[model samples]
Target: MSFADHTIRVRVPGTSANCGPGFDAIGLACTVYNDLELTLKKEAGVKITISGEGAANIPCDGRNIVWRSVQYLLRKAGLLDQYPGAVIHMENNVPLSRGLGSSATAIVAGLKAANVLIGNRFNRRELLQFATDIEGHPDNVAPAIFGGFTVSTVTRGDVECFSFLPKFRMKLIVAVPDFPLSTRKARAVLPAQVPMADAVNNISRASMLVAALCKGNEKFLRNVFDDALHQPYRAKLIPGMYDVFAAARKAGALGANLSGAGPCLIAYALERRHCEEAVGEAMKAAFRQHDVEAKILIMDLDTRGAHIVK
Candidate 1:
């Protein structure tokens, strides 16, 4: 069998999941990104090299998540036997384990790159399903694949994603703490169940949030981000988490929330307000009060999710 030797490069955006009260059902893609370049080889094994964020810790073997994802797609497409080797390079900009969906970037990149190599046999929806299967949820992966803001639900082993780009512009001010919080540790702290009243609170707020964001109704957005589901329980893990949110709001941010299973926190502000710097500074000062140092990134939404670079 003869095949063309070409490198498929994929760039995928970082994502923030569970925006406010939506839990694992909501996410948005940010401008930060990770790039993966996959070149099918005539050899028989995979070679991976990683640079930038988490490079020291991320594996370079077949155990690498990116390679595993590539293999997963190839196996599904019955091309594993035909293409037994690949050379993959990952250049990462998204911070690892910082609630910014870095892992999803890797997964989405690998899947998309492999699919392109196979002549794009799968569409975005099929790619979403494969990503969800690997991620165990669609929150991060949905937005990573489709960009913009995504609301996702998994039903009977199938994933459904509805994505939208906000009609209005806004600043996503992320305060990434120096320390990383593993998603596993954050989820372990959540209680098995919550009171019915708390459940109702989250439901109403989550619904309002989606509508407000979609409609670009800033008035409706204010005060709708309060969560009864996970934030309170996870608060203890992140010192001064509530204080940070309060400070951002006080500093002119419209709303704020824990970014995914987070030590990182995100705030929303109108882009035209030109108050992003102030919001970021307030969040930073608040974290400093808790003896934690954080890096601030004032990012905008990335509407182009994952795409080939070459």
Candidate 2:
């Protein structure tokens, strides 16, 4: 029953939660990913090797999020003593603490890879619940598990998610600012209660957003990516946030908003129109206007959420 001979590799997408109006409810899985390779060791120490984004700051010991997640799952299955150590390798393309769900990516990758190593005793839904429990929300983890665009809600302690992949092609233009805004700090600025009007606005727009994305209705999408819930409060954390959104829209983007919490902004554009570059540059230049240097990444929706590569 030893898993020392099994090497599991899993790829998890970087997720953008909130999706403008659907605060804490909707998420989109992008093409950018973090890949994890996990090999159980018969010995008793955890070892991690990381490359790409956040490698310099990421921990390589038991403190590492990837290793912690693996340990969590293994402990749940009562296999921690039998497989007390692992060699974990992570190649991360997702930025850290920049609203790109980097932690969710790590957690999903670890859980998925660990499950594969243990004979996949956990199903995707079970994995989603485990990830949600660890993440404190299902927005990012749902899409990381199910892929595509996900609308999730937690009821009584269970996670229910509906995932959709639109037939039409769309490009995602993300402008990553130079600074990082932690989710805790971003959320701290929010008011405990919002005006009923703002709440109604978010409800309407979030519903419209889900419907439009599900139907691939481009006309409806143009106005639905606006938020009245978290974005306005979180905007102060990211300089020129609204200006970046305006620049993207003025450059023929359908819409744009904060990717998850703050700092990184994502814009949507039709693939057929070839306006992605213009939108990306517009967002980047807007950040430059505020003396913030930003990097732009052009990506598409990831349909396959997290999967074993080997």
| lDDT values, one for every candidate | 0.93, 0.92
Residue clash pairs of candidate 2: none
- Please give each candidate's TM-score: 0.98, 0.98
| Model 1 CA lDDT for position 158 | 100
Question: How many residue pairs collide in each prediction?
Answer: 0, 0
TM-score of 1: 0.98
Q: List pairs with backbone clashes in candidate 1.
A: none
**What is candidate 1's lDDT per residue for 1-310, written digit by digit as tens?**
4343688889999999999999999999999999999988767988889999999999999789999998899899988888889999999999999999998999999999999988898999999999999999999999999999999999998999999988799899999999999999999999999999999998999999889888878899998889999999999999999999999999999999999999889999999999999999999999999999999999999999999885
Ten residues in sequence with the least summed lDDT for candidate 2: 1-10
